[model samples]
Target: MQTLLKPSFTRETAFLKVKAAEDAWNRRSAILNQTLNTKMVRV
Candidate 1:
């Protein structure tokens, strides 16, 4: 909720938030892909 209630004060802040989210998502997908590959290798 804080994000819902408070608007970003600058374009830079919004851009930073978007970039961080994208980075985190990319990292998560990469980790998941790696785990899946490892499991497949073991099988």
Candidate 2:
């Protein structure tokens, strides 16, 4: 993760990496929210 901020990496590379990571986390968050909602409805 720190590699994304290292000076050795190009700006485009870092930007793309950050964007990809953000997208992945967003997807995970959505899934977690769905699971929590389902559990709450069951209760």
Candidate 3:
């Protein structure tokens, strides 16, 4: 049950949204890097 952050969010919600986005981005980047490294090693 997470709170939905909308355009009209308070300071705390804004920070939460930013942190969530950053964490997601970091996870994606890590997965992409690992995939690339595996392909490079196989080649």
Candidate 4:
């Protein structure tokens, strides 16, 4: 009952955390990649 709900809730929280982290990483990566491309073009 309560124990089963706890596991599902915990999984949901963990998934949210992972998703947020992945989104942040992807944003940073895109910015860095764009900057690198511009620099490469200039060079």
The lDDT values for all models are 0.79, 0.82, 0.85, 0.78
- What tens-digit string does per-residue lDDT give for candidate 2 at 1-43? 3545547779899999999999999999988778533755453
What digit string (tens of lDDT, one per residue) describes model 3 on residues 20-43? 999999999988778533755454
1 or 4, greater by lDDT: 1
- Per-candidate RMSD, Å: 7.9, 8.4, 9.0, 6.1
Candidates, ranked, TM-score: 2, 3, 4, 1
Q: What is the TM-score of each candidate against the true structure?
A: 0.56, 0.62, 0.61, 0.58
Model 4: per-residue Cα lDDT at residue 3:
46
- Cα misplacement distance, residue 36 of candidate 4 (Å): 6.9
Residue 17 in candidate 4, Cα distance off native in Å: 0.2
lDDT of 1: 0.79
Q: Candidate 4 has what TM-score?
A: 0.58
**What is candidate 1's lDDT per residue for 1-43, written digit by digit as tens?**
3545656467898899899999999999987778533755454
3 versus 4: better lDDT goes to: 3
Answer with 2 or 4, whichever has the higher lDDT. 2
Answer with 2 or 4, whichever has the higher TM-score: 2
Local lDDT at 18 for model 2 = 99
Backbone clashes in model 4, listed as residue pairs: none
